[model samples]
Target: MLWATVDVWPELEQAVLVEASASVRKIGQSLAVGAIAARADWVAGDATIDLDGLGPADLVSAAYVLDEIAPASLPKLVGGLWRLTADTLLVVEPGTPAGWQRILAVRSQLIEAGAHVSAPCPHEAPCPLVPPDWCHFSRRVARSRLHRLAKDADVPWEDEKFIYLAASRQPAPVRAARVIAPPKTGSGKAALKLCQPDGSAGERLLSKRDGEVFKSARRADWGDTLA
Candidate 1:
């Protein structure tokens, strides 16, 4: 069966777009605008409207217009858009894991009202679409749940920052390589290393060199160096 996913109330500001672009690329998904202001060329007449820019009174006006055009189709349309033509729905909120929890609550309410539903899967990686400082109680929730699901399903979880994966069905194996970052300068010079379960030595190198940043580094590089 096909699956539909929705990212509700996504911020369309410049910063949000950059992060979202990276996140969408990881999943191989195309970008589409949810709402538009002033009817631009990129916006479809039937496209969903984002009420964020409008004042309360303007929102009321927009609501009236929407109701007049497609009264009964509102909820279904919104839900369908998020699902992206999937027979199953997957609602996503990447910024705040806590927001995901709220979405989960809404999903529960919908299910209780007879909508088909599934348990919320936490996103393991950071959400590229969210601002750097965007923190939430749901962060760990997504990370832990997604990790367990990926391991149990035998799917390789990507280790990128701020991107989480969830599917209506389990995905195929995708190997994820970890990137161990070195400690900042003034943290002292040490060689970092990784010992495999099979007893193989990994990488050994100094933690940092000047302003350059390394993604993965050895832990042994941070301790006191013996000359």
Candidate 2:
């Protein structure tokens, strides 16, 4: 998400990268591109202290870092970050059971802390998906030759799947229904699995007989926000 933030908001003049340990190279990248990699200064043994000195940022990101902390300490950790977030808070986790659980928990905390959801959800209400299922999305990225050779992958590109939340103090723009999964398309019909504004999962079937809506479905893919 740090790399993504550089792309999403190129105008950001300053940023901070929170490290899991005293090692400043927490993110495995350089401090170039105007980011300050800093460790949590206020830490005791097995306890995470509040990072009040770091100050607030326009974009605060906790990327795959929370899984290292105990579940019981989540609320204070999340709430502290929430307080430091000036505009947006991006929390990213793996597409696994534990990761999804963290996403759900942190999302509820963010909502409770009065932050507005900016993506992947349309409202502050409870999540609609129950246990054994979680909300996640995939983004396709081109694989470098070295990557393809190392993984022995057939495709020239790979899908990076993750579960994340984008919350902000500012109001989010109008939302469109998200394609929670890949659309099932047929010769003249398409079946869309969506997470709607009401935070419920529903299937929308569009037939060619419906004309325009069908055309739109044909163009929609997984992870797309459709109107």
Across 1-227, the per-residue lDDT of candidate 1 in tens digits comes to 00111233233222111111345333432333333222112221343444233221101001112223344554553443333423333334443444433344434444434443222222222222232323221222233667768667443444322211123322323322222223333354434432222223234445456223232332223221111
User: Model 2: how far is 48 from its true place, Å?
Assistant: 3.7
TM-score of each: 0.23, 0.82
Give a tens-digit lDDT track for model 2, residues 1-227: 55566576666555555554555443345444235233322232222474766777777888777888888888888898888888988888877768888998998888887889998787777888886877787888899999999999999998888888899999887977888888999899999988888878878999988888789888998878776
Among the numbered candidates, top TM-score falls to 2
Tell me the alpha-carbon RMSD of every candidate. Answer: 18.6, 4.0
Q: In candidate 2, how many clashes are counted?
A: 0
Q: Which stretches of candidate 2 lie over 4 Å from their true place?
A: 22-47, 142-157
- Give each model's whole-structure lDDT: 0.30, 0.77
RMSD of 1: 18.6
